[model samples]
Target chain A: MDAGVIPISNTQLALSVILVLITGVISAALRLELLKPLLWGTVRTYLQLTLIGYALTYIFNINNLILIIVIISLMCLVASRTAVRGSPRAGRYSMLLGFFSLWTSTFLVGTIVMVLIISPEPWYSARIAIPIFGMILGNSMNGIALSLERLFSEVKSKISEIEALLSFGASPWESVRDCVKEALRAGMTPTINSLMVVGLVSLPGMMTGQILAGADPQQASRPLPVVVMLMIAAAVAIGCLMLVLLYYKKLFTKEDAIAHYV
Target chain B: MPEFFKFDQIEYHMGAAGRTVKVSSDLEEGSILVIKGPSGAGKTTLLRILARLLECDKGQVFLQGQNWLSFTPQLWRSKINYLAQKPAVFNGTVLDNLKKPFALKIKKDMFNLDEAIDGLRELSLNENLIHQDARTLSGGETARITLLRPILFKPNILLLDEPFASLDDNSARSVMEFLKRWLENETGRGIVMVTHNDIYKDISGIKIQELELSEPGVN
Candidate 1:
């Protein structure tokens, strides 16, 4: 049996069909014509993950290091999209800066630890590397999204504080520096809190799965708890930096000008 | 006269509390502009227009013979300080507010920390308050500190929009007297403050320009 295979057997199919019916009923009660889009998104997610999972299984069998790197790059693109919807037009250069700052930091640090520090295999396998990359990327995407939204609204709402600084002869950077810091702080707080209570509260998903597969509980859990911590910490630091940099770009123009959006 | 500061047929759109207003006025150099109306006469707009913080639907502001057409707004902002009716304090200490102008590399060479303390004294604020968090200050203290920050920078012109609205009689009188004296000594520099101090009736030799807001909005 494959470590990560989740086959849509008869019982699973029945459950999925029921879920679809319930979704339709909920949409109709809300008077929203979004049942089809909802189904489409779910179906897309299922099909996409299924194909990618099978493809990655083969790539992992081969144990090709180059293939793993390519997949990680593709995941970075997906992470960037999740961070900012229609981002470049909203603020030019934010998309690229956010994408690089987030994906590169988290991905590089995560890959190094998982591959170099702990596993020390012949080559990094896609099945393990890709999934780990996805986990880190997903958490980073959420962090970036929350920070970007809060950062902009903070700037827009506190136009007075910003203008007060400007009117008192401060530059755009000086005026908005504190707002940007608060925005990043809001984004990173959740991940930091989760880290504080990780092992005491519950056994994490990776550790549990490895134990289920007949691996030594202590051996399986040992490396994973540390790796998980590293990925999350990387995600937070990278996510915070990306948002602050993006926000700076959002507030100012080529002339070091503050936008009079409000 | 190069009209040290002038608003040539300038219009203004300003927001206060939750209400917004639009007004238009022309400001001359070295004018002690008094904006008197019952309440909500868009007096702040007159000051914001001069400061270039509030937008004007139509018209131009000129300072030192330029129509304000090309100066980088940051550079222009470095020149004029607008004191608001209800002053806002930033999240840090009073010293952060005082060192506000030093943030701009363009204005760094011109900033003097000593001048900031002196200005605080002139506004009757305790020198020790410089290290205090802004949130700890009262409405009156905050207002004076707000006034103190801009004055120390000594912008080319001062655009005060009802700065005394939140102060007591003694504090208001003292603030105005100190400001008036400072304006008198600076050549080619101007102070245009909006106030409802009807008692001044006519302050001796002060250039008082009055504007009544009763005109219809331009469609």
Candidate 2:
């Protein structure tokens, strides 16, 4: 197979460990105490990526749809757990809400990118599907976490204001409308900021990776980063919207009063 | 026939220990019901329950011969409003805060600038305050704005929790006078207030009854 990408040998890969040592040296000089974690992180990154590389090779060759789906679902599950864990104030049902939001958004956005845009063989190719879904999930996980954390904290802090709105005949949705808007804005800001600076202030990882793999700069810049960024934005928006709508109810009682615990 | 605004045997758990407080009372039209209780006696909780802002363990409220369940919570709250002890100032100008209630779908009334300016005057606030940022208002100004918000909405009953807690004596007197005038202005309106201040004693020509809440954890 005449793949344009040049493979890095084991020796060349081993040489990259020196870059981490440079970080370790800085940590030691500054007495930052991050050396141990940095070394451990380096080892884990090497091991995890190597293992995933082998797994991807096998999965890509096998091309089993069920395996691809299970893998995507597992990624979503881990993403949801990580997102919820970042938000300490998230309520008991937050895990469930996080998982549902991530899965739905990733699935919706991933399917659109795959079927409509990429249209890989058999329409569920593991090579394209996994990476795209993983990218969307990673970004949306941060967005959902930020949105949920903001929503919970904002609602708690603004309880009196929310109750005041309720007393003025506002519905539960109406009462927390401002809080929701703030949370949504918090969730969307990072992605929108990145959109503003893409290619100018920063070369995004996807575009850089494609260029490194010997794809034409113009071709790589045109569809890959643009589509991925848009997909991420959509996923983040949908995920935050779904999560907040589902979780805002937890801040209010069935009788439409602010929940005592909140 | 049911008396004008009545709550029967309202039960709520108070404090971390979850002690229950039972409250029951009624208010006549164009009258005032003063809730007297020491600190931690659950006076505010009782008012919140009446406003449907807190779910009572067991109780029923009837407004104008209709059970509270007969009305939606929004409609019930619109008719029976609760003013918190600490005023909630939204992020906007004072006029925007005053006009907030009218923006709700439940309130069909348009905001009256004349009435709002008049309310500011009655509370002894500068009329120009309406253009100021609500967050910049003094404590006394915030309290009066919060009080004026529901008054403009014209609820059937006003459940006030320490409405004069932040006001000076003169301002409190002006607020009391405004509330007295407000109670007398409509046929169906009434007030259920909790205040340690003695200004209610000066409110003449209005029937004033008192409901003293027993201390929490006391049988």
Best by lDDT: 2
Estimate, for each residue in B1-219, the C-alpha lDDT of model 1 and write its tens digit. 665555665554444453334444455555566666645656666677666665566677777778776777677776777877777777789988777666667667566768877878888888898899988999889888888777777777788877777888888877777777777777656777777665345346556667666443531
Span of ten consecutive residues with least summed lDDT in model 1 chain A? A253-262
Q: Report the lDDT tens digits of candidate 2 across residue range B1-219.
A: 559988887888887888889877888888999999888888888888888888889989999889999899999999999898886888899998999888888975688989999888888789999899999988888889999999988899999998989888988988888888998887899999999999978767768989888865342
In angstroms, how far off is A182's CA in candidate 1?
Answer: 2.0
Candidate with top DockQ is: 2
TM-score, chain B, each candidate: 0.82, 0.94
User: TM-score of model 2 relative to the true fold?
Assistant: 0.92
Model 2 / residue B24 / CA error / Å: 1.7
In the predicted model 1, the residue pairs found to clash are: none
lDDT of 2 by residue, A1-262 (tens): 2386779899998899999999999999999999999999999999989899999999999999999999999999999998999665545589999999999999999999999998988899998998999999999999998998889888889988888899988999999999999999999999999999998998878998888888889988987788899999999999999999988988778889987677
Candidate RMSDs in Å, in order, are 5.9, 2.5
Here, model 1's chain A TM-score works out at: 0.83
What lDDT tens digits, residue by residue, belong to model 1 across residues A120-139? 55537565676677778777
